[model samples]
Target chain A: MRIKKLSLQRSGLAISLGALMLLGACGKKVAPPPPPAPPPEAPAPTASLSATPNAVDPGQPVILAWQTTGATDVSIDSIGPVDPSGQKQVTPTDSTTYHLIAKGAGGSQEATARVTVNSNQGMQSTSNATEEQLFAQNVKDVYFDYDKYDIRASDQGSLQADAQFLQQHSNIRITIEGHSDERGSTEYNLALGTNRADAVKNALVQAGISGSRIKTISYGKEKPFCSVSNETCWQQNRRGHFVYEK
Target chain B: MSNSVRAIYRASLIFGLLFLLAVSSSAQDWIRTGTGLGVERVRLAAADFKGSNSDAKNPELLKTFNDVLWNDLDNAGIFDLVSKSFYPLQEPGQPSEVNFSVWSTPPPNTSMLAFGNLGVASGKVTVQGWLYDVKNTASPQVLGKQYADNATSEAVRVIAHRFADEIIFRLGGGIAGIAETKIYFVSERTGHKEIWVMDYDGANQQPLTKLGGISLSPRISPDGSRLAFSSVTKNGWEIMMYSFDLNRVVSFPRFGGMNLSPSWSPDGKLAISSSRNGYPNIFVMDGSGGNSHRLTNDQGPDVSPTWNRKTGSQIAFVSGRTGLPQIYTMESDGTNVQRMTDQGYAVSPNWAPNGQFLTFSWMRKYGPGEPGSNDLYLMDIASKQWVQLTHDSGRNDFPCWSPDGRHIVFQSHRSGGDQIWSMLADGSNVKQLTFKGSNTQPNWSWK
Candidate 1:
């Protein structure tokens, strides 16, 4: 009701002003001039960019939230262009500042939020216990056939479980250690062990794990889990074990 | 009449002495001297040195020096060392005390006699040694040597080795004996396989690399300044070069694969077997790990490369291209491929100093359900005719040629665990070198 009354009053004022201008023009000796209309006002641009829980531990993820008004194009620094108003999850390895720019007809407006990453010392000391538990309880040893590096059908389920666990704990890094039985040449066994570890790594990568999160090592016939000379012991020695980094 | 007869007798006597000298000198020439039917072993006698000083350590040092010298000459495979029990009761401590008739007699007939005087004072030892031709009564001394150092066990051993080397150089037809060379091998004494170095005769065994991981296939550089071996690291199987000058492991770039069995070229470039391309192949790189180039491109695994020290133009390796691991040779540029072994599993080919033969480990009948015996075999490269040097003893492998090409050192499991053993090139005079903690893969130093 207030908006309607204001419009009515504005229109009435406009009509009275027009009538006064007409009378003045008629009294003038020269021809009446044309009345001028006011120009359209352009909208001002605005932006609001912020990080949810702006402080985080190392290798932890943070959510970036942003909103904008009257923007034809919106962009975030270090993230390229994004939607005008949306949220994104970023896992920064170090402390970072995110800048958002909203551009419109009036001009551009910018907003920034800094995500602070805690130092590496305290986190390292705390993560060791959890990492040890993860390695001891979750990671399993993958076995291989004699003189072979291929992933056997029976081991696929265990490997899948491992991959899922790795995905869940994205901040953890692991080392895949390959071993071989004491039957072949030391050098050849070393190569075979590497192939075994690489096979495991490839399986993890195929299951949507990053290669950078894993490393591989071969202990060919050198570090045997079982020293007995029998098929049962040999099978036990030929394996791929996982070690977590603290 | 009396003066003329006397002059004539003097002339005849002079002529007779000249004839005797010519005959003795010719017989003393070691190159032409041989046993009844084959190459004769030089008969040598090492007398117990007399102690000149009573420093409480002189007797022990002298006994040690005498025993070491005797064992060195006896193990040289070219000498017939007279047993000390058969030696004359009189112990000659110097040239003046050496009675030629005692050593040249029938009971223990020796052509050469070694006598010396050893003394210790204020933690220092001095040794004066002399080698003499027992048959040449007048001017019997052939070699005179003097050595002095701090009275440590190492110093005593070194002095003995030096004196023994001098004797071998004069008696073994100018071929230098390996008295001073070291054999680098892998031992599990520390609960993990580590690179250990010992004297050629297995004395002073010490660990060279304490990586606390499996380290194997230790190949000492020709210059004896670096040792190249493969160890298990977090990165993978990497070739680690241990610099003797730095006394620590130097940096070797990780080749991103299974790098093992590094063999230095005659020029110090390292040739290693790597699986960087998903197949085990030979890759040659500089000692500092630069300028890498592939030497073999085959689907089968190629490994255990040994360079021909004579020309450095050829390499011998083991390849599985023929369905089983066999010895193969190719030029340094990877051309002119030639397979040396026709059948059986042959690996670890070491070329002789003359480059005329190759010694390797072979299983005559290799495969499942076949009776196989791993033994050392020597093959004439030109004829491809091989002679099994080791018989139905235990598993014998990793045969390396001595610097003088007269002997071979290898690892044998005949006595229960793998131990380093050395034998003549003809597979005679087998002597065990190391007995502790399963030693294997011995690399004889070039010098």
Candidate 2:
């Protein structure tokens, strides 16, 4: 009887252990599946840019409006960082493309709006078209480095472009204004800007453009393209901008 | 007995004359260096003036006169102004009304006293003012003057300023007081940068140029007849002259290619930075902008030329021929080129009227990631020892000397925007001169 009792106890222990294993299997089955691997793609950023009066006479004003979705940052090509959705009045001196970039968690999306400044507005189609357009739509501005009047390697292309336009339009007279970021004394900056304007003029003259056709002025931290006191804004301000006189 | 008595009296009379001469010469010596130049200040009392007339304008005119007189004396920077609380109960308007004991005692303890009276009658204002040495009880009065002008608040202020100046001249050595001087500066309150003028103490501010374009560096001609400034016009930057006598922008010969910062010599010659030839260089021209002779020939730009107003023999200018802008001095004829600043960036070297010191703005430690500031500094021309004038004040530049050589006016960005501020020559007693929108580049009149 003792042997039978011992055998009964052993069988009972085995049955209990088996039941524990079955319970562990049931718990595993009840647990939720590893949260479906977060969808590999977050919502991508979207951007749309438009320019009212896409075709303009030289120096005429145009409004650039842009909107973006899922964007933490938005910036324009020539202009600096701006609101995600806003409009800015720009007076482009030449045919230009404004590239807008919207960056977010997913990726960066870009959209562009082209403003076709009609340099041949009066010369080509109609006699009454816009005599005052000034060949501003033809030439481009050359930018320089900080506190430096020397032409930069990056800006060589711009100077070449400006030289090409001037060479084609022999009748155009232009003024290149040298500007500075508001970091130095006004008097000193004035001198710096003059050097910058002269640098550009010398380059154009070297490119076979007549020295008589070009004039230069140093605005010297007085007139600013942007006034936000940041590197981006300062980069825009410290430039040699071109204006058409005749 | 009669002859002896007469001889004794004559001897006493001669002794009195000698004593008076000695006292006067010693007083002159004391006055010479007493102009806020680290000397012990004279304890001064400016008592309220009495309204002596019953005209309807008497009370207002008296108030204006008293206020202006007090401020002018206080701004003179050579006096320990006794508080009004310590004033004697009875304000003395004339010599006879003064009680010397009350002023010289400990309660007031003043050595010099300024008192006055004002009146108005029949569209005219009249004032009588006196300065007294309270310690000299026997002959206490030091100055007594009378002024009359049209009965208006503005005229009353002028009278008060004149009276204050008279006292300052007598007591503050032979130097003329700056109370009547004018300060010309650049202001953008009208949505455009234009030249504006104000009294030395920041009163009567009005625009001098309404060119509706950007104007900078308004340096008044030494004779106060015209203003030379750089203005943006249809033909780039040009040196434009504004005639104070004609109250209009006059036709000055335009030097082409970015003419800027026209400074006038004491003899009426104008020095400007021009790029008419090619590079920006110093050009000394006539007052009419003719006889343009180039002074500096360099690839880097040279600008902001100022003359030694007292001698007119030398000029201090800024040049970037080196890596950065530095102060340089040369003869008026462009000889003896000497560099004044050794390190860092320095510009705007304005020579003091005395010609012994140069005041400029410097960034002693300049570059990216360097912690420093742009501060005004006063350097002795001979010794090259510099004293920092503005400390931790934001971007101080364009320091100009008052006509008296005892004060300096500069533009600072300390109080939010670039504003006109004036301080004593020793860099104390800083006062804001402009409270409106963004005034800068103060040039004190030569007078």
Q: Top DockQ: which candidate number?
A: 2
Candidate 1 local lDDT, B1-447, one digit each (tens): 655655555555454344334433443221122111123467888888889767899878887898788888876777788888888888788887887898898677998888889999888899999999999998888999999999987899989998898888888778787889999999997788899999988899999988987889999998999999998776677889999999999998998778889988878888899888866788888888899999899755788988887788888988876566789999988898899887767788898876767899988675433456889987767657666789989888899988877778999999989899998776777999888888889999999
What is candidate 1's local distance difference test score?
Answer: 0.79
Instruction: Check candidate 2 and list the clashing pairs.
Output: none
In model 1, where do residues sit more than 4 Å from their true spots? A1-178, A195-216, A235-246, B1-37, B53-55
Report the TM-score for the A-chain of model 2: 0.53
lDDT of 2 by residue, B1-447 (tens): 656544554555454344334434444232134332323577889999898767888888888888999899999887889999999789897788999899999899999999978888788888898999999998888998999889999998999899889888887776788899999999999999999999999999999988899999999999999999999888888999999889999999976788998999999999999888988999998999878899999976899999997899999999999878899999999999999888778988888877777889999877533455999987767656566778998899999988777789999999989999998876778999999999999999998
- Clashes counted in candidate 1 amount to 0
Error of 1 at A31 (Å): 99
Task: Indicate the DockQ of the complex predicted as candidate 2.
Answer: 0.13
* lDDT, candidates in the order shown: 0.79, 0.82
